[model samples]
Target: ALVLEMKSLLGALGSSWALAFLCSTRWDWLRHSVLCTGRWHQVRRSVISFRRSWPGKIIMKGSSREWSGTMGQHNMLRFRAGQVDPMSRRLGNLLNMLMLGGQWDRRYYSCTVVVPENVMKDAQRVGRWVSRDDINTMGLLRHNWGESALADRYYPGLYKKLEEYHGVDFHESVMCWHIATDLILAKEEKEKEDFAADKRVQTVRALSNYMMFLLVNRPYMLPGLPQNWLYKQTCNNLDKICNDYDLVGSLGDSLWTVLKKLLGLHHHRVLESSGLEKKLADLIMKLPKEHASSFSETPRLLYARSVAVIILESGVVDKVRLLLDLWMDFLAYAANRCIRESHAQKLSTGGELVTIVWLILEHLRYLKEDPNQQHGHV
Candidate 1:
């Protein structure tokens, strides 16, 4: 039956004249398979001939089992497949479906070979597979489920699958926000009673897991995804979390710490080692007026101190001065917002101004070092 199917597929290829010519050049096996399968001796002889000739011819030009094996190896598919236990074939198939970017559709058939408990165990194994740098399976899940109807409809199921498998509840604020956003966008019910009950548990868990992962990894670049696209996704998640969760509470403190790490603003070591000074400057430049104005005076002063360091390192004092001039204009806008709202009392407006003066003093010291330095002669 398999041979007949192969022959039918090959026959369809004969309509293309070039394929016909190629097949004609390789017809010896076809002749043998048809002519010799009848008698016992002929069948043995044909089997030997078939093994030698069939695979080479059938694979077509410039392709080989070895080549496919190499591709599978590169994709981690071969390694994963080889690691599958004989008893866990169903779990393996589920994993393979996920690896291949298959979505969970109601119409898609799934055989119930194992109980939900075992299935959940298998799901945890799948989650572990995603932590490896080479596997990137979770990234695939996020790609498919982040903005899809499947994410909306099967979110609870998906989260349950993850939790049952991984034994972690992963209920971070950012994650909760992600679920909430998806639910809202999907026009899902937002019943307060349901929110406090088991109905919202899975969504909450999935978000929590995601947030925990991010907190530990502090990832600057997400593999198999563009940086800007990942940044946008993260920003949306962060915005939702902030809007829904209180920032002054314990949960808010945890979130603030994570955000500080994400923004590369936690420790001085991170600031220096992570190449984040300029990134922070860019972020500051891009912030909405309200957000930009929320920084306490000391933090703004520290930002100015960093700006001075950047200016000295840049070796373009004049250009740095011009950039600072423009930055002050932005600060003025933020200050105006604070003043109008009577929130200036809680922030340090004077410290920022003083920091600017200190920056000017440092620039003069840098300028006085050498006339030759200005012209890049040394």
Candidate 2:
């Protein structure tokens, strides 16, 4: 074994000198050949060593490629399959954001998983993220009953609004989806070199995409909310808000971005400069009074408040992790709301964001089974 190993090592040497050295009998030729042979091995080893240590050589190719601004369905499928996990920071961190949502700490805020206190009391741990008692959780009740019983308790105004409008408050999810798509556009257009590494950017990107997936494809599980593509409309408004300021190619991947987004003052000068406000009023005026009245009063801040609330407790001045976690948990709730078949149908067409999230949740042992799942199961 040792003899074979030695021979193999010597064979790896790229040298005619080593061959000559072994067979030569002349003293000077032998010495010169030996010297050249040893140097050959050293040079060969050094080149091999350098290749191993070269960071550029090892950088994942996917990260180097232009990010898919659309977060296309196929991309979602690959990301969920784990083939892209090691190579794609954008998808991986976004996945982590969903998985670690309430548990992650930004020093100011932490993501919290909520169960109705009554359910938690009776709950016995089952799956890692879920338990036996939580079968009748928020979304299922909303699905079966066509309205979340707990909605009015926790979000009365939103609940009342949904009651009247007959939908849920996922405007934020759709909002995030728009922000993420723009970030992808920003990344591709060379808007920011650090866009992929920026967690705050990734958080909005992931949350928004996942939420929009719910709003678009899984409306029934969203308690069949009847918002008129409010999510899609807000995406247009968000893009306009930035374009009004020529910030489309310059969306900052930072902690307080939500504040900049939601605050009317940030877009104040731009709105005045562009006369977008008056134009918006003109458009709103054309709608029927009831529809116009309920349509967003401040298109600029439509989903900004939703983003703001997700990140509010995160010590916005300090860190983005807490905010990321909150959005993750928020999206996770959306991911968990469906029966298996709804996921399959949407997944077949373009892929659903919630399916990936739910798989990861179940894989990571964080899922709590929806108690009402039996009734909704196909």
Give the winner by TM-score.
2
Cα lDDT computed for each candidate against the true fold: 0.28, 0.36
Candidate 2: which stretches are off by over 4 Å? 1-133, 137-168, 171-204, 213-223, 232-236, 239-318, 346-353, 356-378
Task: List runs of model 1 lying over 4 Å from the truth.
Answer: 1-190, 199-204, 211-222, 226-378
Tens-digit per-residue lDDT, 1-378, candidate 2: 785565345444533444465546468765565555676557555544543464322322122212212221111111122221233324335646788421211111111111223222111211322322433534231232212322344334443432322223554434443342332323232434653465454444444343444444345544335464454355345334333433312222244633332231122111011123222322322334344333365342323333333323323342233333334445455556556676665553334445555554444343335654323221
Best by lDDT: 2
lDDT of 1 by residue, 1-378 (tens): 786676444434332343345446568776455434533344434433543474324333221211111000010111122222232334335756787312211011111111123222322222121122211332212221122211225233433322222211211222223222222212212223343333223322222222223322222111122233332343333333233332121111244643343343332211010112222223333445455434442232223333333433433323312222222222222222222122322222122221222233223323444544333221
In model 1, pairs of residues that clash are 124-165, 170-208, 170-209, 171-208, 172-208, 175-207
